[model samples]
Structures are given as structure tokens and as C-alpha cells.
Target: MNNENIIDIIYGNLGSMTATDQKVAHAVLTAPKDAVNYTISELAKVAQVSEASISRFCKNLDLTGFHQLKIQLAKVADDESSYYDEINIDDVQQALTNIKNNKVAEISNTLASFTTPTLKKIMALINHARILQIAAEGNTYPVVADAIYRFNQIGILAIGAESWSTSIGQTLNLITDDVLMIISNSGESKALLKQIDVAHKQGMQVIAITNRKDSPIALKADQHLRTSVRQYVLNSDYYFSRVAAITAIETLFLLLIAENRKRLSAIQNHENIISTDKI
Candidate 1:
């Protein structure tokens, strides 16, 4: 059983235990591995309860003696390698499902969290932008390119920062009419942060899309759209966060397009006229 199941078991048996036994229960719940390494007297002393409470805890878990219970817990520690191997497989599926759920939830959350003031800020920047640029590194770079497509189709002069030096140079020369939307998962990329800072100094609007709410990039952004991705095990991989990031960018693209439908229609009409004349 997992820590959650262990917690459930303790709570389920709560009514049967005395006040002192409850103290032991609380300690075990608070620090199970620590409790596993503690002796009966040591636990009772720490919990400010009696030794009998520790003995009762073992009984509560269906073990005959405290030593046997400790041995079982030790076995659990020993079996962790196999348990986690199976968990990785299960967690991959769980992470995938979580990404799907989180992607939908993020769209809803971002829409709900969005405000008129923020929209006006972004709209003003986009409306007058001479060259709207988006920069992202690693796994998130594709999202930036996709966003550029939507921006260009809607008649905005938008492009992706495909190279680091190019991104920095483009950002350095940005005027008051430029806009930069930077996407990063960890939000700690040095190059991206430097680009954002330079853009801000150069009078360009900077927007951020990231999973970490507390990241420096999010803090530095003129506007932030935060995304959340679930990590099943320890969050060492990038399965869920990438999906969340992609979905956020797509949602932003759709919303921006919807907001500028009149301009988009005018552009389409012009294109249609030119195509007909050519034919």
C-alpha cells in the first residue's frame, strides 16, 4: 500500500484507539519512515504518550509484535525497487491521463483567471506591434512556432526565434511597438530570462507561459498564463508539462484569433480578391 493507503488505514482505526494511541497514530502518519526506525519507548517519548500506545499501533496494523511490524516495514523498504519498477509503468499511463485532464483544466482556468485589464495590455501590444516575436527553448520551441503561424495568419507580423544569438539580437533591437511571448517549462533558462529582461528594457511587452508559478520568468512577465502538469512519481520527466504548455499556447492562439475576427476577415477578403485577379 502507498502512503495514502497507510493514512486511510490509520484514520479508519482511529475510533478503536485511546487518546494516547491516537498520539502514536499521528506520529506515524506524520513520519512513517521515521516511526519505522524508532523504538517503542522512543516513539512514546517523542509523541508524549505511553509505551502501550506503540504496542497497540502494531496490533492495529495486524502484526503480533512491534518487532514484527518493523521487520515488515523493512521488507517494504527492501521491496521498493520492484514496487517502483511497476509504478513507473502505471505512472506513465497515469501521467498521460493527467496531462489530458490538466490540459483541459488549464484552458478553463486560464480563461477564468484572465481579466479585461490583462487582455487590454496584450491586445494593445499586438495591435501596434511592428514585429511580434515568440521565443522558446528545447521541448517548448514547437509551441512558439505554432503560435507564430496563428499570429501570421491573422495578419500580425509574427515570427519565431529559431536561434539563440538571433533571439538575443532581435530582442535587443526591439522598440516600444514590439511584443515578445516567451515559453519555458522550468522558467529558469538563462538565455530566455536574459531575452525577456532585454525586451523589457527595450520597451517591448513580454508574456510568459510556464508550469512553475514561482519561476523568475513568470515573475518578470508583463502578463502570465500559468499551466499545471501532474507528476506521478517524482516529476523527473517531461511527459505532462509539455502537453499542458502546448495546450495553453493553442488556447491563446484561438482566443487571440477570435478577438480579432474583423481584421482577420478583412485580410481574408483582400487575399481572395488578389487570388481571383491572378486567376
Candidate 2:
């Protein structure tokens, strides 16, 4: 079946996939053109996934085998260029359409970067930690505030320290299992890097959400969740959209919320107390 929505399902299901299946998904989804030409073994190497994992990935997608997976990827590749264009020089009406497409693409691609296992690990860390320290600067601070608020809602003690620089002292004082989450677009901010190092030295579980998978923060953090996006520039200033990062945070927030019936009941009780929807 050459369902056109297959690619969307593939990309969007990354957070729900087994870590092994996620590897295969990331490999092909990252570069479908190269993937379409890859033999099963080659794809296995590229995705760092075993052949057995690929087969399982295929089956999960309801495909027969690797051969069928290749064919589907190829078919989807051929049809993809018809709509997914990067350049947008349209009138306002068409610009609306472009914005919609770009946002959808950003959200899809961001979600594609996560694995179910990693998200579960993050949930464990957050739930067990005595404090959740969020570090961000400039454009990323809004993300920190959102993270702290949501974490608080989930009954976790959390704060935004502007950046990790402010948390080093607290790290020495807090429980050893405190978690530090970083939201940075560049992931290379010198201050942030130093903070990551400090957190690590203090034995904190440090995680990062960044647009660059290879950036220092991503590489150095205990866990990295990526939200890389297509670049857009206008009037000589780069337009960096946080839509993907926001989606990633929301996904984590919801997953944390869904981790157990206890959380669900707590949320219900909490909502019963504070939410204005009672009217």
C-alpha cells in the first residue's frame, strides 16, 4: 500500500518507537534520497540499527520486509517534492499556506528526533529528582519558563536559573539526583557549556533540547532531545522559530502527565482545585 501519509506516520511516531526502531526511522527519515538507494545492510549501518531491528521496524509500519520498505520510501520520496518546498516567495494568501506547511514540517521533523526510550528515561529522571533546574538564555528563556510551570504542575520542584551558571551553588546543596534541563537553540553558548560541566561534576542528570544534534550541549548533556528545523532568513536577520521546541516540550509534558494513574489522579485533583472550567 502506497499510502501518502506513511511518511508522516513514520516521522511522527519517533517518540513512540523502540530505541532500535527509532534508529531505523531516523536514518531513513533524515535522508530519504540516500536511504532509497541503500541496501538493507547499508541502511542498517547508516541507522546503526541491526537487520532484525529493520525488519521489526518494517513490521511495525505494516510493511512486508526491507524490500517493501525501500519501495515505499522511494515512492514517498518521488511524491514529496511536489509539496515540500523550502523557498516561499508568495503573496500573503499563499504565504499563509507556506507558514502552515513550514510549521507542520517543523513539528513533524522535531518529533522525529525523539525515541520512546529516551523520553521514558527523561520521565524517570524528572519524577525521581528532588529539583528540576532549567537553564536557558535569550530566546530560549520562554521555553525554560514553560518547562518550570509544567514541571510544577506535575508536582516537581523546578526553577529557571537564567542559565546553569546560577545553579552551580544550588547543585552542591540539593539532593544528588536533581535534574538540569537545558533549552538552547545554538547549544554552543559558552556559559551554558560551562554550566553543563558544572552540573555533571555535581552529578546532576543534565539533559538538553537543542536544534543542533552535534552542538556542545547536545553532545555533553546526559541526554539530548533535538528539535532541528529548516532555516529561514529575511531582511538579513535569521528567523528562528521555536515551534518545534515548543512541540517537543509539550510532547514531553504530556508524556510525563501520562506516566501513571497517580499522576492522572493528581492532575484531576489539582484541576478540580484551580482550573476555572468548573463554571
User: Which candidate achieves the best lDDT against the true structure?
Assistant: 2
Model 2 accuracy (lDDT, Cα): 0.73
lDDT minimum window of 10 residues, candidate 2: 79-88
RMSD of each: 14.0, 10.4
Q: In model 1, where is the ten-residue run with the lowest total lDDT?
A: 78-87
lDDT of 2 by residue, 79-99 (tens): 442223344576776867766
lDDT values for all models: 0.66, 0.73
- How many pairs in model 1 have backbone atoms within 3 A of each other, for residues 3 or more apart or on separate chains, i.e. clashes? 0
Tell how far residue 217 is off in model 1, in angstroms: 1.0
Cα displacement (angstroms), candidate 1, residue 238, comes to: 5.0
Tens digit of per-residue lDDT, candidate 1, span 1-279:
222133323433443456777677666644556767999898889888778877877776666777865655554343221121212345788856555564554444444445578766777777778999899987778877877866776778887777878888878777888899888876778999999889988988888877544567888988876664432334222243456667776665667777877767856865786697784
